[model samples]
Each structure stands twice: as structure tokens, then as C-alpha cells.
Target chain A: MKSLSLKNLAKTYFDAYKGEHVTAIRDVSLEVPAGEFVSIVGPSGCGKSTILNMVAGFIPHSGGEILVGGTPVKGPGPDRGVVFQSFALFPWKTVLDNVGFGPKMRGVPKAERDAIAREYLALAGLSHAADRYPNELSGGMQQRVGVVRALANEPDVLLMDEPFASVDAQTRMTLQDELSRIWEERRPTVVFITHDVPEAVFLANRVVVLSKGKVLAEVEVPISRPRVWDRLVADDEFKDLSNQVLALVRSA
Target chain B: MERTSRISAALIFIAPLAVLVALWAVVVPVFGVRPQIFPSVPAVGRAGLDSILDGSLLRHVAASVSRVAIGTVLAVLVAVPLGILMGVSRGVSAFLTPLMRFFSVLAGIAWIPIATLWFGYGFGAIVFVIFNAVFFVVAYNTLLGVSTIPMTLRHAAASLGAGRQAMLTDVLLPGALPNIVTGIRTGLGFAWRGLIAAEMIATDVGLGYMLFVARDFYQTEVIVLGMIVIGTLWLLIDRLILVPLERATIERWGLVSA
Candidate 1:
């Protein structure tokens, strides 16, 4: 059974200044089963981020519906947690407070919230930075906080939008490994969106390619878990999938 | 060059003041001006010491400071939350902005005649003037602050499971802090000026009254002394308190110079 479903999802931007409408997503639909790591790959400004925002309910979709566990997603709730591209940690809050913010909003007591946050912090390998502010950390470290903050609530589905896009190559690789490890342990349904083909192939069980608000293709990665991206770069299956995805992204 | 000089530059500013003072000490005598018109530096200093010794100076200073303190505190306590509430909602911000800006322009000295008429010539009248000076300015600035916080940040918080209250406490307040503090400083500047003007016109006590009373007695020395005290007090508040607080807020979470 599908854990998350998108049905006839459409989004349009009304250009108030120009007196026109632009369609970013038009009747697009996809589904992710429970505990499956799915990543959506798309060209820039192709409504990939908008798709995620639709799922997270940060923006009102111009039309259609999104469902998680058979209930319509109207607005943001603790059931689905989102990690933003920019790692939008509350600058005034320490890592602990930021991570615990989900539970704190749910009216969880301070002690219980702290315990949950502590568990996620440890899972993210960021226990030492719990008391530090976001500004005090590097880009990769900031994303770690973002990830922990989302997972602290023990969300049913974790949503990530170009989460590692800002990090350097070394940091991105390390973060991918961390994400892979986290997925291996928690088994939460994840819907990650990225433009980078190699990243999608390295992490996702299924890669959905989108172009002009439509799903172009959905390919399943046959690679085994505990991925070593560097080693996998030499594997024939990895190379072929990467080349195909790269060509598709480049053409679109 | 601007950065380096900002780091090292000080005391060059003192030279111009020293020259002005030296010219003051010599110019009056050279021009044969009467002491009543322009008291000598030594005479002003002597009056300053006299006021200090008699304890009247301290009382007047305390009175003015206390009124300003009470008024500004009350204004911030009231203004910030109200401003944030208005700011969070499009309907409220649009509805209140014109009204708030209208009143901000009418802050400080403009309120004097009505304030005195309403509250009578005492602490109430003086506080009313200061409150008017602070309330609208701070409120307007706070509304602006909340509005300027990026929409994406608020949405991000919401997606991360932050509710309405958490969004306010975490994102809204902190993001608006630099502007809020800036508003307080500017508001208090107008407040201090309003306090002095109100005190002169309506109150029997405080620095403005001290200066005005000195004028009645042709005590130019005391008048000069009062002006000096006002300048010094303002400088202290700006340098030691408001400026540092503003700097800290901007450094921690402030928007860039854009």
C-alpha cells in the first residue's frame, strides 16, 4: 500500500504585476510506499521544490490533493517533517531547542521533548553541537541540525528539498553517508528532491524524474544498501544509470 | 580605509571641541560681551559645582530620568506585542500602519499642549509627553521589523511542526529584535526631548525647569550648566546602553546592510 500519494497535483503562479498565470505543476501524480526512500530529480525551476512544498503544505496548490496514510494534507502537521534547503534553523535558538521545536509545538513537556531531541541529535552524530547556534556551524553541520529537527518528532514521512545542495563536495558525501545510515536505522518514508543525478542514484530506492511539472520517468536503483558512492562510481550498473539520468536531466 | 580608521579613530573628535572651548574662553572677553548674555566657562563650572553641592541638580536629573524610564518601559511593554500581532496578519498590518505612522509623526513635542491640559502640571503630564514620544515610534518600527522577516523562514518553521505560537516566539521576535531595539533608542531620544520640553512648560521640577528657572533669575551660568548636563546624560545613554544593545542584536541575527 502507498504510504504517501499525490493525485492530480497542479500548481499555478498568478503574476499580479503581469496579469497572467504560469503553470509550474499540472496534474502531476506519484506515490511512495511505506519505508521506501524515493527521490525526485528535476531541472531547475521545474516545480520540484514546489512539489515538495505542496506535500509539506507550505504553499496552497492551485488544484488537486496530496494524501499521507489516506488523509488529505491540507497544511503542515507534525506527521510529515520537512528539512529545508537552507537549513532554516532558528538563529536565536540552540541546536537542542531547534531540534525539540516540533515536540515543543505539540505541547510535549520540556523533559520529554529534550529526551527525544537528544536521541535524534545522537542519531545525527551532532550531540556535541546541541547547545550551539546555527550561525556557529558550517553548511553541512547546519543541515545535520535541520535533519535532526525534522526527525525529533518521529515523523511518518521525512521530506527533504535539495538538503545537501549548499554543501561542498566532501561535506555532501559525508552527509549522504549519514542520511543513508539514518534511513537504514529509522526506516522512515523519505521523499528527497534533488537536481543532481548521482545523488539521486546513490541514495534513493526509486528515482522519479520530473520535467515541466510532469513525471518523465521513474527508475528503481538496483544498488545494495550501505552505499560507498566513490566505489559505486566504478560499478557498471551505477555508471549506466548515472549516464542515463544525466542525459535526461541535460536534455530536459 | 573606512574599516581600519573605524577601528583606530578616536580623540581627533576631541580636538575640534577643545578648539571651540578655547575660543569660547577667549572670545567673550575679546568681544566685551556681558556675562548675562554669555557666562564665562569658569562661572558655568562654578554653578555646576554649586548645583552638585546643593543636591538640586541630582533631584532634577533623577526626576527627568525616572519619567523617561517609566514612560519608555510602559511603551515597549505595550507596543512590541501589539505591533507583532498587527504585523503577523495582512489585514491588521494594513489597517494599523496608516494610523500608527500618523501618530508617530505626532509623537514628542506636538503632544505638549493637550497632554498638559489633560493630565495637569505634574508627573502625569510629563509622562504623557514621554509616552507619546515613545509609543508610536516604537510600534511603527516593530511592525516594520516583523513585516520584513522573510516569508520563507516562517513557512520553514511551520513545515518543521512549529505552530502559530512557536512561530511567533521563535521566528518573529528574534527576527524583529534589531529593529525593535533600534526603535526604542530612536523613540527614547524623542522621549527625552519631549520630557525636557514638557517639564519646562508644565512641571516645577526637572532639568528643563532648572534651565528655565535659571533664565528667570538671569542665571546664565546655571543655564549653561543644565545644557551641559543634558548633553552628557544623552551621550552616556547612547554610548553605554542603547548603542551596545543595538550592536549586539544586529551582530547576532541582524539582516545584512542591504
Candidate 2:
């Protein structure tokens, strides 16, 4: 695991429809120390996804320096793993193969990679699903695979873009719980992007609220460990933190 | 239950062709149709028996099937890599797409006349026609398949440490497989028609040649037998081989919508 730093991040693009230069992200800087879970929350079009994309190296930032473990970010690399909201599991690959894909790319032997995949699948509580195709699983189950597939690579930093946004509310909570458990156990640096206020607070060590491509506020969550929706749902500290982050988002 | 349904489905498919044959059997004899135009069922059956006994039927069928198999394999081998190359590079795809569209329309039997001129009216010519028929459609569909893959899947693969070769094998290839299979099916449809047409014009030892030569001699029974063999061979190839391949991969994997 490694720390992530974004210094003076800015994005400006030519808008074909508007026929003018549009600035999406304007001068934002943030740091996520190694093993810390930082969730960036904002309303739609606030460039939250853009920030994550830039960090993941999926898109080039117009002006910025993104450092992962003190190394400059260039393009997408194995050091940084990404979990997308779309649950982009390879439909043609069985669950085991999908999870094993990263190790396979690294030229790990078949038996060793399969073992690694199995271990990760167990971590996500998805051992029974190993032989099935992605389409055979429900949306939630697919996302569980997505999370483990990323984790199996053992990347230095894990980037998630609204990973739970598309699943049902109930399933989302369960996924959040699983993610929290995984993070506690593995302690990989995470930069999670979402629009949900409670979700941001529930999962992050600190929540960074953004508006119009700039960080509006950063709030620390002192909520105790092993955070689950069951307890966090009724916890005053959790509610207060969520409300504080919600206000920052709304004010933005 | 599945076995019964499969049997019933086969029966349902065969019923219409059986009825057509029955209608032909009754009409040809009852109306006293000229044997020169359409031979009696028994006459056609006799011709079939004679060809089988003489081993001519096996030779013609073998010749045609081998040509199609060789041509399709070569076309797929070349087209898949080219299509993937086009899929990854916008400049290449943009330049080639228009060319592919234009040539695909001229695929199949249209190429036979030129093919014969180039290859001198033999195996080369017929195989060229079949290759021409299969190549463009598969390449174009492969391009469609690769382009249609979601961007995020590529992103995920890249972030998971996939390099150029791994990206092709692990993501682009499998991601494009459903369409590749679909393309092969459609291209082979064209190739089949083109093969018969080419064989008629160029080859001396195939089912199409059998039909064409029989026409000159007014041996309508032989022609009818050749037609039956051609149709039956295609049905068997498509139903037994291609459909099952499609079901085992794309359909079973739920890659395509029902």
C-alpha cells in the first residue's frame, strides 16, 4: 500500500456542444496516506469521478501531478487497481479466471494464480461463485467479484468509482460492510468516489466533499472500527458525521 | 425433459421439408411431369443409389466440404488479427471500415469470375471465392465486436496489469468472440452459396459440377440428387456444428441477448 497525492489538479476541455473551453476541475489538491480510506463525495457533474479517473490514469489530467507511493503517475498500471461502478467483469471469463486475470498477466503459473484467486474469492465470501460466469451472478454478487478481483492483484492503491451506486440499497449496505471488513483486514490505500453522503462517511476514515471540481471541505470520521450499517445506522456519531458531510455537499 | 424438447425441436424443423418432399412425390407422378424437367422421386432415388454405390457421391461431397473448411480456416486466421488491429487503432479502423463495407457487398459469388481468371478454373478459384466470401464479413463483425466492448472493461484490464499481448488474448479476443462467432456463421452462409456457384463455374469434381454437367445431359435425377446433397450438407453443418458452437460459448455464457 502507498500514499496518493494530487497536487494542483485541474482539467480543462474543449466542449464541442458549447463551442467553448470548459473547466471541470479547477485547482484541487489532496493527500491520502497509505492504508487510509478516503471517500470523495459530491453531487453529479462535480467532477468527483473525474478526480478518480485521473488518479487511476484512465484519463489524462490537463494539469496535475499525481504521485502514488512517491512515484509519478503516468498511465494505468498494476500498482493501482480500479473497481468500476459498472461491475466490468469479463463475461466470457468464469469467476475464478476473472479473479486470476491479474496474476495471469504477471505470468504467474496457472496453479499459483488459481490459488490466489481462490483465496481472494473466499475473502469476498464468493467461493461458491468461482465457476460461474459474471452474467450468472446478480449485480451485487458481480460487484463482490469486482472488489475481490481488484484485491487479488494486491495493488498499492485501490480506486473505486461509485462502486455501490448501481446496486440495490440493501445490497449496497451489505457491500459497504464487506468492503469495510476487507479494508480493515487488508489495509490497502483506497480512494473511493461516491455521491452518497452516508456511504462516504460510513466507509471512509475521512470524507472530502467536492463542488464544481474543487474540494469544498474535508471532515474526519472518529467513528470506531468494525463499522456496520446495523450499528452505524443508529449511532449518533455516525449520523452527526453523515449530516455534517451532507450539509457540506448540499452547500456546495 | 430437455432431451424430449430437443427431439421435438428437430422434428418441428424437419416437418416442413418432409411435407415439401411429399408434395413433390405426389405431384410429379400424378401430373405426369416430364422427367427431363423434374425427374420422378424413384428416378432421383436411383441416381442417388448409383452415385453412392459408385463412390462418386462421397468424392464430390468430400471435395466441396474440404474446400469450405480450408477457405474458412484461412479467412478466420487472417481476418481476426486484422480486425483486432483495426479495432484498437481508430485511424486504421476509420480508413478500413469504408473499404470493408464496400467489399463485403461484393463478397461471395461476385468474386468468382475474377477468382477463376486468377486461379485458372480449379481448386484455387473455388477456394478463393469461399475465402473472399468469408473474410470481409468476419473482419467487419470482429471490428464491431471489439469496438462495442465497454471502455471500462479495458480500463479494468489495464489497471490489472494487462499489457498489449495480454489485453488482446484476455480481453479483446474473448470480448469479441460472440460477434466473431456470429460473423463466422453469417460469412459461412455467404461462403456456402459462393462455393456452389464457384464450383459450378470452375470445378470438375464437386456437387455443383455434378448438377451443372447433369443439366447439359438432361439427367434431371442427378441434378436433383446433387441439389438434395448440397442442401442437406449445409443444414447438417449449420445445425450440428455452428449452432452448437454458438450455444456452448456465447449463448451459454449469456453474452448475447436472447
Candidate 3:
């Protein structure tokens, strides 16, 4: 059974300034079973982020249905965690507290929550920087904290919106590897949105190519797991999938 | 190293005052300036010492300080929470912002005549003037602060399962604090000046009263001493209290400047 599903998903809004109606996404549908990592890749303004936001329940979809564990998504809840591209770590909170915030809000005891946060921070290689404020950290480190913060909540599904798009290319690759390793261990259902075809193919079991508010193609990655960046990029399977996805995005 | 820098900072601040005093001593004596216009430096010092010995200076200082403390505390207690509540609703803020701006502009010395008439010419009148000066400015600033917090932070908080009370404590209050502290600093400045003006017009005791009463006897030394006291008090409050508080909040919560 699919862990998460979007059936005939659509979103529409009134452009008050322009005095016109705009459709951000329409009739797009996909499903991800538990423990699957799916990435949606498209050109700018293709509404990939909109789909993630809809699944995260941050915004109401104008039409269609989104289900988590076969239940309809009503609104944002701890069951689905989100990592934003901008690394929205609370500036006022320390790294430890930022990671622990979700559990704390759910009324987890201080000791238990801190312990949960510590494990996640360790996974993100941020244990030494736990006491420092978000502003004190590098952009990559802050986004690592952002990832751990979502993970610490123990959500069934993780929704990431171009989570590493802002980081330097080298740091982005490192973070991609780190996130993939963490995903391998935790095995939560993840829906990641990005514009980079290589990144979508590198980290996802399947890449969904979208454009003009609709999914154009869904390409499965035949590259095996426990994938290394250099080895994966050099492989024929990776090249074929990346080229196919790139072509689809260009056409879309 | 920290201590040495701190001491240097203190010296940097004091050096100007030392230069001012030296310039006053040299220029006044060199120009043969009359003490009547600006009291000779020694004469002002002597006058300050005389007030200190007579205990009248203490009384005036105490009176002024107490009125400011009571008025400020009362105003902050009510204004902050009220401002935050009003700020929560765009409709309420839209309706009330103009009223707050109007009242804040009319704050302080503008209220002196009406305040004295309402409360009579003693502690009540002085307190009312100070309260008026502080209340409207603080409330208006608080409203601005709450309104400026990014909606993304609020959404992030809600998505993390923070309820209403948690949202207020963790998000709203902290988010609004930098603006609130800034408002207090500005309001206090207005209130301090208003206090002196009100004391001169309505009250028989306080630094303003001392200055006005000294004018009757042509005691320019006493007037100079009162002015010094007022300047010192305001400087101390701003540098030592409000400024530090404002800096801490902004540094802690503000977006790191690009």
C-alpha cells in the first residue's frame, strides 16, 4: 500500500494585483509507498514545490485529494515533517533547542526530547554545535540542523522543498550523501522537490519530471542503493536516467 | 583583554566630559564670562555640594525618580500586553494605529495643563504626565513590532504543534521584543522631558521645581546643578539600561544583517 498518495491534485488562486486567476498545479497525481524516496524535478515555475507544500498541508489544495496512511490530509501535523529551502531555523533558538522543538511541542519530557535531539544532531554531525544559535552556524550547518529538526519529530513522511539548493555545490553533494545515509537508516517515505536533474536521479528511487503544473514523466532509477557519488555518476544507469529526466524537463 | 577594552571604552566616554570641563574652566575665565549667565565651573560644583549637604537635592531627585518609576512601570505593564493583543488582529491594528499615533504625538508636555486640572498639582499630576508620555509610544511601537514578525515563522510554529499559548510565549513575545524595547527607550525620553516640564509648572518638589524656584532667587548655580542631574540621569538610563536591553534582544532575535 502507498504510504502517501496525491489523487488528481490541483491548486488555484486569485492574483489580486493582476485581477486574474492563476493555476499553480492541476490534476497531477503520484503515490509513494513506505520507505520510498521520490524526487520531483522540473524547470522553474513548474509547481514541484507546490505539490510538496500541498502534501505537507502548509497550503490548501484547490481541488483533488491527498492521503497519508490512507487518511485524508486535513492540515499540517507532526505526522509529516518539512524541510524548507531557506533553512527556517528559529534564530532565537539554539541548535539543540531547534532540533528538540518539535518533540517539546508534542509534550515529550525534557530528558526524552533532548535525547531524541542529540541522536539526530549526531546523525547530522552537529553535536559540537548544539549550543550555538542558528546565526552562528554556516548555511550548510543550519540546513543540517533544519533536516534534523524535521527528523527529530519522528514523522512518517518527510517533505523537502529543494532542501540543499542554497548551499555551495560541494556542500550540497556532502549533504546529499548525509541525507541519503540517514534516509537509508530511518527508511521514512520522502517526497523531495528540486530543479536539478542529476540531484533528483542521484538521491531518489524514482524521479518525477513536471512542467506547466502537470507531471510529464515518472522515471525509475535503476542505479542500486548504497550509492557513492563518483561511482553513481560514472554508471550507465545513472547517465541514462539523468538524460531521460533532463529531456523530459526540457520538453515540459 | 575584555576588561582592558571595557576600561578603555569607559575612558573613551569620560574623555569628552573631561575636555568639556577643561574648556569651560579655560574659556569662561579667559572670556571673563559672568556667572549669572553660566555659573563658573567651581560655583556650580559648590552649589551641587551645598544641595547634597542640605538634603533638598536628594528630595527632588527622589521625587522625580519615583514618579518616573511608578508611571513607567504602570504604563509598560498595561501597554505591552494590550498592544500585542491589538496587534494580533489586522482590523484592530488598523483601527487603533491612528488613535495611538495621535495620542503619542499629543503625549508628554502637551498633557501638562489637562493633567494638572484632572489630578491636581502634586504626585498625581506628575505621574499622569509621565504615564501619558510613555503609554502611547510604547503601545504603538509594540503594535508595529508584532505586526512585522514574518508569517512564515508563525506557520512554522503552528506546524510544529505549538498551540496558542506556546505561539505567544515562544514566537509572538520574542518576535515583538526588539520593537517593544525600542519603544520603551523613545517613550522614556519623552516622559523624562515631560516630567521636568510638569514639575516646573504644577509641583512644589522635584528637579524641575528646584530649577524654577532657583530662578526666583537668581541662583543660576542651582539651575546648572539641576540640569546636570537631569542629563546624567537620562544618560545613565539610556546607556546602562535601555540600550543594553535593546542590543541584546536585537542580537538574539534579529535576522543577521546581510
Best candidate, DockQ: 2
Query: Which candidate's TM-score is highest?
Result: 2
Per-residue lDDT of B256 in model 1: 47
User: Which segments of model 3 are wrong by more than 4 Å?
Assistant: B252-258
Q: Model 2 over residues B177-232: C-alpha lDDT tens digits?
A: 88899999999998988888888889899888988999999999999999999999
lDDT of 1 at A134: 79
Give one digit per residue, the lDDT tens place, for model 3 in B152-179: 6676676677778988988888888888
Candidate 2 residue-wise lDDT, A74-129, digit = tens: 99999999999999999889999999999998999999999999999999989999
Report the TM-score of chain B alone for all candidates: 0.92, 0.97, 0.95
lDDT of 3 by residue, A167-235 (tens): 999999999889888888888899999998899988899999998899898998867778768687678
Model 1 chain A weakest lDDT span, ten residues long: A224-233
* Model 1 lDDT per residue over B1-258, tens place: 987785555466567768888999998888987988999988988998888999999999999999999999999989999889888888988888888878878888888888888998889888988988888878878888898887767876887677777788888998888889999999999998888888899999999999999999999999988998998899889888998898887765424452
Give the runs in model 1 whose Cα sits over 4 Å from its true position: B1-33, B254-258
Each prediction's DockQ against the real complex: 0.53, 0.87, 0.56
Better of 1 and 3 by DockQ: 3
RMSD (Å) of each candidate, 1 decimal: 3.2, 1.0, 2.0
Judged by DockQ relative to the true structure, which candidate is superior, 2 or 3? 2
After superposition, candidate 2 runs with Cα above 4 Å error: none
Ranked by DockQ from best down, the candidates are: 2, 3, 1
Clashing residue pairs in all predictions, respectively, total: 0, 0, 0
